[model samples]
Target: MIDADDVRRIALSLPETVEKEAWRMPTFRVAGRMYLTVPDDETSIAVRCPRHEREELMAAEPEKFWVPPHEASSAWVRVRLAALEDLAELRDVVVDSWRQAAPDRLREAHPALVPGAEAAGGR
Candidate 1:
């Protein structure tokens, strides 16, 4: 399961990144765009997801994921590591969150990160 340290490491893995304490958590941003949040009290994390994909993701993994309290429907989802055992999948989700928050121009320049991400396809 992914922990706060894991989240910190992953967030720092991306280029031009910084961690700021916001929303009572460690918020990770790239060029001022937020992608991930390290929870203050748990191993779970809040990630920026495509608004359109939020419901689908919650439905698919209701236990492991949820639209964070007060932030549901705002393109943010909180994922609990307790139920999600696959760290690789979590890594992908975190990366995708970073992709969403990244500027379109950067996404284009770094197409290798999120393959087909800027091609207007897949989650």
Candidate 2:
């Protein structure tokens, strides 16, 4: 099953990503902007997501996505690791979040990391 370690591995593989401690948990950042966090339990993760998309994701897949009340106003979503289909899916989600936090220069340099890039002949 996908787990926190998988999240860590995939996140760290991104360009300019760093692991930092915040709120007593591990937060992954790109260009100094946090994009993913593994909470204390390590069963799920919080990742950058626009509020509109987050709501749509949660509504479409309640078992896999959600946000706590305290973070309701934040543009982030919590994903249950166990609900992921495989490492590839985990990588996709992590990379998407990484892109959100990554600076424009980095994103431009790493076009392969952008969602749907492979199908569009990127990389």
Index of the highest-lDDT prediction: 2
Query: For residues 1-123, could you state the per-residue lDDT of candidate 2 as single tens digits?
Result: 878888898788788889999889999998899999999699999999999999899999999999999999999999999998877678778889988988999988987777544423433
Worst 10-residue stretch by lDDT in candidate 1?
114-123
Model 1 global lDDT (CA atoms, 0 to 1): 0.75
Q: Which ten residues in a row have the lowest lDDT in candidate 2?
A: 114-123
Best by TM-score: 2
For every candidate structure, what is the RMSD over all alpha carbons to the true structure, in angstroms?
Answer: 4.6, 2.4
| Each prediction's TM-score versus the true structure | 0.83, 0.92
Which pairs clash in model 2? Answer: none
